[model samples]
Target: MTDPKISAFYVAVQEVNSLIQNGGTSSSRSLEEKIVEHLENAQLLGKLPKMGGAQEEVFMEVTKHGLRISAARSRLVKLRIPLIELVLLTTFVDGFGKTHAVFVEKSTTTRYQLHLLQLADDMAANVLCSLVKNAFVEAEEASALIEVIEPPSPSIA
Candidate 1:
């Protein structure tokens, strides 16, 4: 017997990978778009917890440096994406720029941790914000660029 939740999660991850491989932006109806669509059809979005408050509102946060996804707990579970992996991904996104998207996938059951990245040009960012607003239907904390600071070197004996 197959675990249905795991299967669905894998599908989402696969969709994300496909979208990134193709020339699709967060604004484009690419992998993230398709995965979200599937969630909607399955009625998974609302079934999950909202991000901030009672009045729902959803949007993607794209600072000049990074991309963040909110309102995606029930539809998809969060998994650890190590810092090294994120760096590699960001590099790829920079290379792709507006012409392509970058994504990562991992599966423990069927699919576990999956993420997508796109070099957000101003226009793409704006469009993505709008689409996320419509689909997410919930407000969330602003996404900030994660700066990994190393601990200061310990004094030698």
Candidate 2:
């Protein structure tokens, strides 16, 4: 299932591009095309610790605060990748032509997580990415709306 407001991705693989720092490589091709190219060669990794299932059903929603990932059936949020924590967002296309929404998250100063989410189509991929990007911009604007000020000190005695 997919929606403009949210996207449901079958998490085909996590940590697929863990070794890469910037969330896959740069490409001059269209976003979807770049994904397809990487899909052929992206590293195959084992299941993440505590994350079972060949394909994990997760729902992703971009909010004012961050990007939310939740269990589809349970509706329990697994993780929220804050705007400040997101490294980069990229997408890929599987051989079947499904869209894979890839995002790198900075879990800690020393740890990063790469997620390969398989979306139903290209439109969902576009919507999700746009929302995430917009959220980041909005958050930055909100933070910069006001600046701290200090009153001048009284004249020295």
Candidate 3:
């Protein structure tokens, strides 16, 4: 039997994809807002971290050598290394200054990991921030559809 939580999460993801495909208006609720609302309705948000707390910013300095992941403070152990059985949601800049968001899920007791989501734009950074704040509960359900939507590239100023 399929897990109800997983089913609900996929439904929410499809809804977000529909909104994006239809070219939702500025007055309409955004994909992030819709995702949060669906997750809330499904009672999955409680399993995740609460938003609006004091966040420890970990700056990923873009360099020619490639971006290295590091924690800004010792208290944030999750940022220090690639963790297992945990969700990683972070944003970084490429050498060209374009921002990208990545989501990874690591398996416990193994070196296996899944790169579930990646988006190249600032709006994705905002979405990634939301996902991180919520501890990425049910984020795996959205993984399949994430690649299908191509958000417009960030315009260089």
Candidate 4:
């Protein structure tokens, strides 16, 4: 996040269908390709094509609480999502020749969103995805570092 060269981006956001996933053992590169294929299939099926309403210039950052999306100038929060609730994040180029970062949220409805972010450029998208995925992995590792044990209850006389 502290990279001096991080670029500012104008981003479009929209609620979308969840992405299709494969068996858990695939490599990272293959998983990304799978996301692209799934999205293309979705578009061909008349789903979530060119659907983002508007593009807002935003200063997005990865925070301890999760990813925080803010209005670029005013700094007001647009969306704040806890990473634990974020099921998946991937990037793909769309039929309209635009790139997007799509993710699924598991909070309640298992909803997903497509962000037509400028970060969708190949290098930027890859970097952002890696940052998020690595952070999520780190969070899971931290939580699993401890073991929980149940205490026995005393018998009443």
Candidate No. with top lDDT: 2
Ranking by lDDT: 2, 4, 3, 1
What C-alpha RMSD separates each model from the true structure?
15.1, 5.8, 18.6, 6.0
lDDT (CA) per prediction: 0.33, 0.66, 0.36, 0.60
lDDT value for model 3: 0.36
CA error at residue 62 for candidate 2, angstroms: 0.7
Per-residue lDDT of 18 in model 1: 42
Against the hidden reference, what TM-scores do the models get? 0.23, 0.69, 0.28, 0.60
TM-score of 2: 0.69
Give the range where candidate 4 is weakest over 10 consecutive residues by summed lDDT: 3-12
- Cα lDDT tens digits for candidate 2, 1-157: 1334455555644442435444355644553344345555543332222222357678888888788889888889877888888877887565545567777777777776666777767888888878887888877787777444455789998
Q: What is the C-alpha lDDT profile of model 1 across 1-157, one tens digit per residue?
A: 1111111011123333443344355565654445444334433445422222242122234332233334434433234433223312211212113222223443332333333333235455345444434322322222222234455899999
Looking at candidate 4, what is the lDDT of residue 126?
A: 74
Best by TM-score: 2
lDDT of 1 at 120: 30
lDDT of 1: 0.33
Error of 1 at 93 (Å): 20
Task: Determine the backbone clash count of candidate 3.
Answer: 0
